[model samples]
Each structure stands twice: as structure tokens, then as C-alpha cells.
Target: MHIAAANREDDLQRLHEQITQTRLAILVTHNEQGLQATHLPVLLDPQQGAKGTLLGHLARANKQWQALAEGAEAMLVFAGADAYVSPGFYPSKLEEPRTVPTWNYVAVHAYGRAEVFHDAERLLDIVSRLSDRHEAGRATPWSVGDAPADYIASMLRAIVGFSLPIERLQGSRKLSQNRSAVDVEGVRAGLANSPDPLDNQLAALMRQP
Candidate 1:
């Protein structure tokens, strides 16, 4: 990712927070046929490696999993809110009309070698933890035990799990940080007033200190 100095976000805590906030990631891998991508709901184990480890699963019927050898290269792309920016929102546009429209977004890229596993026990633990995490705060939370034991076991057999110990992490948050304070305020105001939900989301991120 080509991140401008003003947009670069390398802070460890912030990066992990971004990953946790966006549980679903696009897992990218390559094989003989070509590149393949899967949308995976992953759990991040922050203490497991130099950076951290990502845990996720794919359906057994998915050919993408069949390409995963012992240690295959992979990347997890986590995307946050994004919105379109118009030069009309910038105060500087009056003085310097050369400004053009742009898009603002937040994203994290994780690169590492992936390890695949099919052990029923490990798969069970992974599914159970993911369930508990997402089900929290619901009026009635569901757990893996809610299903019949044999049913759960049978379901687990239809998927494959993988672990990726992150070797590197890159984060970028382009929220008009490069713009002048006055212009940024104008942009935020314009976005906040827009009816689009994504625009409102970007405006909210810009409010962060």
C-alpha cells in the first residue's frame, strides 16, 4: 500500500484495534492456477507471535483450502470505513481551485506464511471462541454447545482451519489529515451532513484526536 507520510498508521496498538474492530478479512493466496481470495472471519491472537497470529477457517469444499501446503504465503486485508471527498468541501478550494476530489479510507494489510490444520479438536476450539466473541452483548447469545454434539462434530468436518503468524503489518488511514485544519473542518462538516452512511462514518473517524 502506498501510504502518504501523513496517512501512515504504524502504531501497534492502533493496528490491532483496527483488526479486532473489523473481524472479517480478505485472505489472499496464490497457487498453480492463480491468485485466490476468501472472505474470512478471523480471530487475532495478539500474544502468539512477533506481530500476532490470525485464525480462520474455510469450507472443506472450497478449492482454495486445498492449495494450502504446510507453509504457504498469504495476506489478510482488513478494511474500515471509506467515503468520497469533494473539493467543494475544502475552504482552500476558493483560494486554490486546483484541488480535486478524492476518496478517504482506512485499511490494514497483514503478510505471513499460513499453517493449515484439520484436527477436529482444534477446529472446535476455534469455532467456539469465535462464536463467543461475536455473540457477546446480544440479548440472547448462542454457543457451540447449543447444537447437538454429533451435529457440531459433523459440521466441523466440512471445514479447514488455518493460522497465520503475522510477519508484517501495514496500516493506512486517509482521513484528510494532510489538509489544512480549516479545510479539514470543512470537509468533516460536509461529510457529516451528507445522507450517505459511509460519508458519516468517515466524518466520525476524522473527529478522533
Candidate 2:
């Protein structure tokens, strides 16, 4: 979230869409035990408010929820395409030998107040959407009712659902935006030729104006 002005994305709609596409995010919080981080699939609902809100659930056994409260602030980090940028890939490195290795990536940070919900109805809605999103492309898509009704309800009772009302949105596109146009082009070409799928994806993002 420490974004330079040149790379910052201030558009709320675009940022929210990017969040929705992100399959996973790291939720960070502070507590008496110090910093605690949890990786989960979170959905950002723009319909809730102007700043949007994050919805997700955690296991009942997971103690991270105890630290989250109505007014407590937490950070949810969504990572997009990213890859290692070798100086060897930069065209300028060959001519001037001044370039150093760095990383090219895109990420968004949402800081907000968390509100934990235990209501069965809300939890049902949350779980249904989450399951549908993950199973969207599957040939044999699974639904909440695939399991026994009582079993599903019991399972839901064991987990905790929560919402983080985002108060701040920050984004960064570090796709060699600081490099010279010539260097960026070289990097983009190099990444496109990489064997790594993530590298190729990052190269595609770099093509954006």
C-alpha cells in the first residue's frame, strides 16, 4: 500500500473490481499476541457503501476472530500478478550496467473496521455466494445443499462470518512504472517470453496505459 503517486490507483470502482477478482487475500490484525495474519478468500461488496466492505469467514478454532471487533481496524491485502524482475532482463543493464534486480507486481490494500456476525441467516447467504464463486467454472459444481441439511447447518455453526467495512483503499501497480519507457518495453518483452505464467500475466498488465 506504500504506493508512489505515479503508480497509485485512486479509482474506487476499478479497485473494487480488482478486489473481487483476487482469489485470496491476507488479513492482518494486531492483538495482545502481536501481529496475526490469516489468508482467506474475501469478497468485496460495493453495494454496501461507497468504500465497499469485505466479507469472509474463519474457522471457529481460529483464534484470530477474537481480536476482531466492531471498531477494530484490520488490513486486507489483495495481490494481483507479480514476478521476479532480473536485472539481466533489462535492456539498460546491458548498456549501462546500473540497473538492479526488483519485483514487478500489483496489489491493493483495504483498511477497515470489522464487524463479526453470528446470525445464521447472514452466514448462510455469505457461504452460498462464496461457494458459488469458487465453483462457477466446475463441471460438477457443488452447492451448500450437496451436504446433508443438518450437517451443513452444523458446519456453519462451527465457523465465524465477519465483515470489514473498508475505510481506506490503496493500490499500486509496480509493473516497472518507475523505469524508462524503453526499459519498461524491454522488461515487458522479457516477461512475456518467461516460462512462468505469472510473469506472462504481469507483462500483459504492463501493456496498459
lDDT of 1 by residue, 128-172 (tens): 999999999999999999999999999999999988899999999
How big is the positional error of residue 192 in model 1, measured in Å on the Cα after superposition? Answer: 1.6
Tell me how many clashing residue pairs each candidate has. 0, 0
TM-score of 1: 0.96
What value does the lDDT take at residue 202 in candidate 1? 90
Error of 1 at 11 (Å): 0.3
Candidate 1 Cα deviation (angstroms), residue 65: 1.8
Steric clash count of candidate 2: 0
lDDT of 2 by residue, 88-203 (tens): 87777767997779988888999987889788888888999999999999999999978898998898899899998888999888888788888899899999999999999999
Model 1 alpha-carbon miss at residue 63, Å: 1.9
Candidate 2: list runs displaced more than 4 Å: none
Per-residue error for 121 in candidate 2, Å, reads: 1.0
> After superposition, which runs of candidate 1 have C-alpha atoms over 4 Å from their true positions?
none
